[model samples]
Target: MADLWDGALIDAAIWHARTGDVARQFRYRALYAALPVDALEAAHLPLRPDRPGLWRLRRQDYGARDGSSLTDFIRSQLAPVGLSHCQITLVTMPCGLLHGFNPVSFWLARDDAGLRAVLAEVSNTFGESHLYLCRHPDKRVIAPGDRLSGEKLFHVSPFLPREGYYVFRFDPGPGRFGAWVDWFGKDGDLRLQTSMIGKARALTASALRRAALRHAFQPLRVTGLIHWQAVKLLLRGVRYRKKPPQLEIRRSEATAERSDV
Candidate 1:
């Protein structure tokens, strides 16, 4: 497997008419890296932790725990679903000097047959995170546009209530990748929709340099945009819900069996 996969994506979020007729949409060009967990120990990639560079990934940023190897954590997470000896490609933004603020990251696990499962690590601005394990009902391989759902356990956005669920659709490929997630109310109404589409590029120093030059301070920009949008929502009279206590680690929930919106 390649040490890393570098790419760029257009990250967008749309808050549907959940509170009044207010709908807000924002788009930003961002840089992303698909790194294999096993490759973290190898010195084959240009980006490294605590290094001066355009982009870098830190070990403490992800995985089931802060100090554990990501590969081991992923394998443990997949073991419950009977997925063993599978390759995992983590699709996420890198943290450099400016640091990263990823709302979510995808871990695509595949075996000999095809894509087996996906582990989504979701986070909020409040420094809390949750993991949602999404798979087919019969352990079937997931394909592009396949629908997956999970109950809302951890609080993410203050504007969003803690009672709704999330529906996810993914389009993953070697040349490109796309993901869509929609938050639905208890009544099954779409409250918010967010999606990301990106074209893959060969992971190399040159590619990383070009992406950094094009989207300098991409991580900070992502955080800034998030807050700016929240401000806009607050101005629109959207009531903010109090954030609950943080849950550092939680068990993954099975995909919900329900109609797709």
Candidate 2:
């Protein structure tokens, strides 16, 4: 199938950029931490194809308690109330200046209040995870003659499609931005490994062992909202149930599985 830009992709990136909750921040940090340095640097800009300059970016590994560096960076970005990152989305233009730039057509706004919030939220999230903040610079901004600065960094959201909580969406992948699921659970939790770390290449299918107990109890009913809230509460409550998280077996054992495309 031919690759194309449906609104969903942009929506995913936007959603990730906007919602910067605690879970989101942790997940984002995990995903970033999980990425190899080479892969991380592979991320480039998504500038308009027709633009004159070549949009490139270099993402450095963010190493802070949670997102301390990110927070400081964002705070610096917001210092100029009249000059926020979202207000002016920065891109690296190696070729040259982009003449006749149409902010409207490009959907690049001067006052992306929502985007700014997301940026801050992402910073907040990264800080909490104690994961280091990676350096992400706008290639265009650093180009010899290009304008020195504007908002260049962005956030990535983690969410798995099935059997997990729905966190914000972010541009975790390079080609298509969308939701990513933070699939961390107990160390031996297969679900956790499959989702977050990577899928099992040799998931041995064990025949269902007949347990002494066989009767199935009726599934309890709960409202979606209430169920979600309860799930969240339990997740938080169980976090400290055991001290020291065990290293992931599946992630290390299975070897990295990623999109070849």
Candidate 3:
């Protein structure tokens, strides 16, 4: 993977059946990049903290600290899983000046053996964040179409209950990236399904500019869409659940069960 990748587009959708069978979907283009921490600090990218341009990426918006390197932060998070040496690549939507909203972002950790582990950062509209550590049970490299399950510990949406499990599937590749997350009820029945699929391209100034021109207010649009969907769900008579206390970190049941991996 290259240090930077632009022109990546995402087509995402969600389906829910808790309240009168409500569903909402949207499609938007976004830029994806894999910036090594050292390179990100030294390189001259167009990302700014508070400014309006084609596309801007702020370092403080991710990881744990305001000015800390993301690579180091993610490395520490993966240490408990026996993953020491690996390359971290972030797959997320860039923060635009109008507004920045990332429902979820993936941090792919690759080592000599292949994909060692994945750090999934989930954010809610209330500005709370949670992390989910996913890895294979056999300590082998994770391959495409592999499924990993984790318990739900954080509150994200009002329409969905807090108690349940999430089944995650990924199909990461050199040319395309795809992921699917299914929320299962306590009875082991499917309740909600969400997915993201996109293609990859080299990250360059021109590519960023083009993407920005095409989707200038993507961040704002995303925020609006989220709230709009929530309203739709409410109007449909879905029971609203209050947000629960936030959990800083959560590990998959499989990872927590086995200490060797």
Per-residue error (Å), model 2, residue 166:
16
Top TM-score prediction, candidate number: 1
Clashing pairs counted in every model: 0, 24, 1
- Residue-wise C-alpha lDDT for candidate 2, range 119-221, written one tens digit per residue: 2122211222111111123211111111111111222212221122112112222232222222322221223210122111110111101110110110111
Residue-pair clash count for candidate 2: 24
Model 1, stretches more than 4 Å misplaced?
1-21, 49-52, 247-249, 254-256
Residue 31 lDDT in candidate 2: 9
Per-model RMSD to reference:
3.1, 21.1, 4.2
- Cα-based TM-score, every candidate: 0.87, 0.20, 0.83
- TM-score-based ranking: 1, 3, 2
Candidate 2 has what TM-score? 0.20
The weakest ten consecutive residues by lDDT in model 3 span 252-261
Q: Which 10-residue window in model 1 sums to the lowest lDDT?
A: 1-10
Candidate 3: misplaced stretches above 4 Å?
1-38, 44-54, 248-261
What is the C-alpha lDDT profile of model 3 across 1-261, one tens digit per residue? 422222233333333334124554545444454444444455544443324465666666777737566667887887777775777667777776577788888877777666767788888898877787778766687777677888888788988878777777776666677777777766676777777766556556676677778766777888887788788778877779988777655534423221111
Write down the lDDT of every candidate, Cα atoms only.
0.71, 0.21, 0.66
Q: What is the lDDT of residue 7 in candidate 1?
A: 27
Write the residue-wise lDDT of candidate 1 on 29-94 in tens digits.
Answer: 666777665554465555554455666666677875485677778888888778857777788887
